[model samples]
Target: MTSGCFFHEPIRLPIDLNEQSDTLKGTDLIRVSKFYKDSKDGRFMSFLHDDARTLYDVFRKGAKESNNGPCLGWREGPNKPYQWLNYNEALLRAKNFGSGLISVGLAAGPHTLVGLYSQNCPEWILTEQACYTYSLVVVPLYDTLGPDACAFIINQAEINVVVCEDEKKCNLLLDKAPRCLRKLIVIKDTRPTTNQRAKNRGVEILRFEDVERLGAQRNHVELPPKVTDLCTICYTSGTTGNPKGVMLTHQNVVAAISAVILQLSEYKPTYKDTMISFLPLAHMLERCCENAMYLVGGSVGFYSGDIKKLSDDMKALKPTVMPAVPRLLNRMYDKVQTELQRSCMKRILFNMALRAKEGEIKKSIVRNNSTWDKLVFRKIQESLGGRLRLMLIGSAPLAGNVLTFARCALGCLVVEGYGQTECSAPVTLTIQGDYIPEHVGPPVACCCVKLVDVPEMEYYAINNQGEVCVRGTNVFVGYYKDLEKTAEVIDEQGWHHTGDVGMWLPNGSLKIIDRKKHTFKLSQGEYIVPEKIENIYIRSQYVAQVFVHGESLKSCVVGIVVPDVDVVKCWASENGIPGTLSVLCNNPEVKRLILDDMLAWGKDAGLKSFEQVKDIYLHPDPFSIQNGLLTPTLKAKRPQLRAYFKPQIEDLYQQLD
Candidate 1:
């Protein structure tokens, strides 16, 4: 399908990588698929072709078959969807849903119904997979967006129905029900508000339980969804503005899953794979992984609602694999440190223990030291479901120290990967046996990466810090209904300018430097990478989040830090400091402690003379979505943050000795 004025193509998959690049030399890179037919490996494609048939088909056909069925799609009580449906059960559920639409004789049912989602809630998976079987298009919603934004997407995709999991979300749809949504299904036990606010204009209403009941009653044998029909519409995280819903076909989704799984299989088979579901399934990364779990018959578990409950949930689920962003790993590091600081004796012993562990890792000494793991790290492991063999870190750059410690101390293999929403989430992931530091590993299976200069925008560059461009089947088609914006990213050529600046290492791994938009030239003519600096600041125990800015300023760098309140409170009680965390941040003694920590960390990071942070201020508040300081992906809004802190920054720089 052509994306209006952007490009004209039949949406064919590229078997040859080189030819595909030539075809997309000028178009947006997001439009491509993640996989193509493996001409050399008939067995591989045959495996995928079989998987496309049924959930169990792939598991039976895979090189390694699992004893356990994949997935346990669940909810709390009666009237809810099935509590723990395995792969076969889920497939049956999808068939039931797909056939029910046909049995009901709904119009426009020929076209696939894709769900646009954001939350990690399991319903996203159920609806998505069910729609896939019926040849319906499913679009995932970015729950972080406002009402108007959600309405715009619902209208653009021509979505007829939405299954909202919570009351707040149900109200959001209800508010926009008249102009867009034709049907609204609430997931919770509570009915749509009895108050006038709960009533929506001109939309049919049903509880999510009712819909599942309808599916449960339908025949499970009929199949209508074709591989060629569209499977989903995943909207890109609006780094710029309103998100564009990208159209993905069943082939596209399967291709993405195949690419990632093939790459993963070369390292470890998925027979008994256990993974935690934390990242929202609305994201293509999680969706693709979810599909892989079904295909491989792996076990998947959900995290409890709150992050505080995640540790407890992990202990229960015992996930062997986890796909997450860098921020989660960083937080995990903080959790370890906080536990260590519980007591003076604990702190001393932990330090000495960490040193010993470091010595063992460096020496390549493999010890099945049950005593050490059981006594020290097993509790942490138990908190994560106990069986975590590997943790996948992505979405952003993870601190090298965090990666090292999880491996050494936690006994969990933390592997860092890289990708974007546009590229079905991951292009490169670290293999189990071979991993490289400060690199996003090698491209997965059939994907390819190349660095290129923005000839048009090259006038602003200093070195060979070119944009990290990509070409793969996992690339998206184009922005939905915004040809003008789509054309800007994807040229007539297929190369999608990732906007990220990076270089290829000699060993063929990718090292991301920074986003082109984020790289700024310092007063001393040194190009400063804000992300690099911000990452270093966040590595400090006291700082939760940091933003570095040097725009229209002097040689010295300045930062705004969000102190870890709990850590600060603990430190205050010991030091006999007074008042709340916000008050402590401003207190003379507390400020001195923080500054001392910052200065020491700055030196250790080997900052350039001009790049050292001279003036650092702690914010009473965190940079959250509510405050507009964070993107939907939880990335810092550098511009917004700098503007917000302008007054405080100015006062800090005033020459008042």
Candidate 2:
């Protein structure tokens, strides 16, 4: 039978069930989208909007549907009100800017790559749309990628013209002076010396306004891309070695957009819906979500370059949809918990309301219930602008308790998804009403998922636990200029062998349990998945961040933990132990307390003795992108962390021995 949003309903089951059977048995190993169950190969055949073939078509369709609606918005500065551009106005500018590219000696074609070096801003989207008009592929560069990496991408892509946010970014690029680069277009004013430096480096510097004016004078026609044309080359932020350029085509991105539209069809998005963009636009998660918003004629506002001011931006925008990563959500979760602990009565009342709402959640009903919402959760909801209805979480695993808390407190459909750059950012997503944690729903509409055995890790398809492999229109064509690496990931049958290990739940949802590449065999011949262990340890109230490490020669694992500063401070104050965080990190008593709590948590979760951490070292400072210990996506860079904490890790092992 069909349900709400016909596209979301599974038309046919992969496996047949016997009516008399007690247990639900899904015999089929491969999982395909319900919408395409009748198809021979179950490949994605159409987009939600049939006319929307390329990214440019998506914007044009939105402009036609919501011509006078606000399309893009940006703040003048911190605490400033957002300024906007209507859909028609933005489209005109995009065309003008695209024509400007041609006027400034950039040839329009699929082969031409245009570098976009900027934070999330209206200018960035404009440049992206502008490139779409000329069929030019966009290559994004971010701050986390140092000058050398940026220059490497520039040379590899053979980019001739780059549209930078300001003079500082232009200078950073010019400092590298890559041979393939010829022109630098600064969005803001460029100094005389900056222009002179570019000239000396055998490149021309031009103002963004000059290019737009030139385009206006020329009035060149739009050269829209075909469905098969290359859209963008998103470079993955590698934890080790150089980044790989993932090549996504027009069809790939459009299919991804279709999957989102199909999944959220019940919500019926319109121009009134707004999203505040803060995540780096260079990532596929933000890029794909923003495109989906545009397809629905919705508005988007850019956060101020400063992440510290994101809360202020949220207040101003009052966004209906939020795209988030677990790192940010975890911080929010910590803040609310810490605040609740300040008062006994407040904590009791909050728990009472949370328990009541959680009861309703178990019934598959998610809403801002009148009584609890108005009395207890209203302030919490208002903290995120009071208009949030949906939050899409990806990049990393979110604790189940935090997921439950966010749904109860925020009164939004907090969905957790699993994806990577190779699949246009969403392989699976939790259904709108499913409150289950750990599993990332079923395969998205554009893709079918299957599992392959990893004998080395003892995972097998027969047990429904193996490496997750995806085949779909959403998958990228190949990594740019790296056929050998491409062949390593994509098999002969076109399945992209995602390095992630997954288990198929009874309800058909996929649970990501381990990483194929990140496993290490301990001395006792037992394998350890450090990420899985770390996730368990991080659930401790006193633990903020953790890195679990095990060596081949070691019998047990050790950890480096960064404690929750506020919680730790509160504990210290109550215990009459006075010291700064740095000093307290070295306090043996504090260390012992944290370790005991984490071990207790591990035991409750049924961890084996060898799986539990044998010893731990408390760190005052959190692993951050600035320190090169975490990726831009906030995932720990294991190799970097190991190198940085080598001495501490050795000490932990020595103590354990």
Candidate 3:
């Protein structure tokens, strides 16, 4: 099973961790499964998986139990059919890949750093597993990154071996990278055009198959990875400066997965379920999600490189769970709602269904498959392969209205979590049936959370808003090679300053408010959270994307808005307006309509007087990852946005009414 791809294998865990019995120890926290031990310390909660010390151990145990289980699914092309690989076969492949690394004189040690530059795919996982097997630190680079970014990370992390998707990515670094790089491994079978150049430079070129064959023939043995051993140096998506290499150890990842499992005790996701992987593996949250799937013996299907084909992929896989970010979820919501708005009757019935959903929420009910579920909700479900039941949203703050709309209209149980790459991802997650639109639930079993006062920003724990600080086993070691940066975030008390502001709800859930340190003051001496302001304006269907800016001492706000294309097109057809999306965005009347709608949204959000977007400039092109306006996870890069739109913003200030 480990040698090659095969089909018809059912996912099976060595044993159902959920079926293992547990006894509640008279406290709010419980070690609900036999997989872990309950915390006896003074901390509020804890879960120690005594046996699962390292990531390799976790997968090794699962692979032994689910040797022949179908583990991974991917496609050849957008229109191509899907393919499968079993667990035993994947492990063997990874072992061979690891052995191949050793044979090349690239023994895994403290200085060993391997770079993986590719989109999410089965090979990425295989390479990562190989890294784990050899105890080599994996350094992941975003596939969308430019040449400079690629070169910067490779040099900064001192990557000696690099694995890429194709010749294109490999070429970006081959010439510019440091001479320390020894090997270029391509996932594709085709020979790289830069192969000769790499060889001339004394850098070896190995196809993925070559690595596997080397390891299999070499009879590689898996090194026992220690809990404290460095596993990966995950770089943060630098919306501000150069990407920082986050040093995450095997213990950090183990603690994170344990906490995630503790939070999801009720769902008990196991080998029987399936998940769709569309997010980049460079992002720690998505990486963590894939790891959790592998540990639970659940199957994961990789989405094609073209994200526009996700709906088609969904239909083919019929995945049970989907891990997403706010941008993706919001886009899905927008597309579905736009179609529903096509007919007046359809829109009316959708509103009626929303009201019924609100009533069920107010009454604390678990819907026993209602009439609306069959009529409208089921269609949205079918469009997404008809089997998606749970969605895990993270990487950015989700709007309350969007959350409500997803549960009410899309008919999926949506759960939002809050964390960053520094925290190894899920610090807190919403429970399955007990979800609050505003709150992101409590800290996970292994984490201890607190909100510290930030008087400079007028945020205080008493007012229910302060900088969120976390201390736990899941917390990362520190910023790689930057002790000064490490000391700034982690202190003598061992708390990792999250930089994000949050508060505790009456129900003890955590509600993330805004960034504490990055905010600037507006004219009237009001400190404004730019992301919050932008999110509010985006709630209006008229505005697809927005970036809010306020000058020091300026009472009013100016926004750069990207009008929703579908909504604008519909409006143009109905109002006798004639223009493409770009032309309409610059149209005075359309601009007025969008600005008015955004102003109304700000008002509805109960924003301060200074928070109102008094003037707006429309850009036809949306904020995209490619343009550097947005991060890979779709979070706006505020500094970059301001610099790019400086001229428009300056004119807006002068023309302010």
Tens digit per residue, CA lDDT, model 3, 56-86: 7776655654666888899887667678888
Which pairs clash inside model 3? 1-89, 2-88, 2-89, 523-553, 523-554
Best by lDDT: 2
Please say which candidate is ahead in lDDT: 1 or 2.
Answer: 2
Best by TM-score: 2
Instruction: Provide TM-scores for the models.
Output: 0.83, 0.93, 0.90
RMSD after CA superposition, every candidate: 8.5, 4.1, 5.9
lDDT by residue (348-465, candidate 1, tens digit) is: 8666766676665554332324456656766666666666655677788776666766766665555677887667677676544332357776566545565666544352223434
Q: Local distance difference test, per candidate?
A: 0.62, 0.85, 0.76
How far does residue 482 in candidate 1 sit from its true spot (Å)?
1.7
> Candidate 2, after superposition: displacement of residue 222 in Å?
1.8
Q: Please give the TM-score that candidate 1 achieves against the real structure.
A: 0.83
Error of 1 at 93 (Å): 2.1
True-structure RMSD for candidate 3: 5.9
Which residue pairs of candidate 2 clash? none
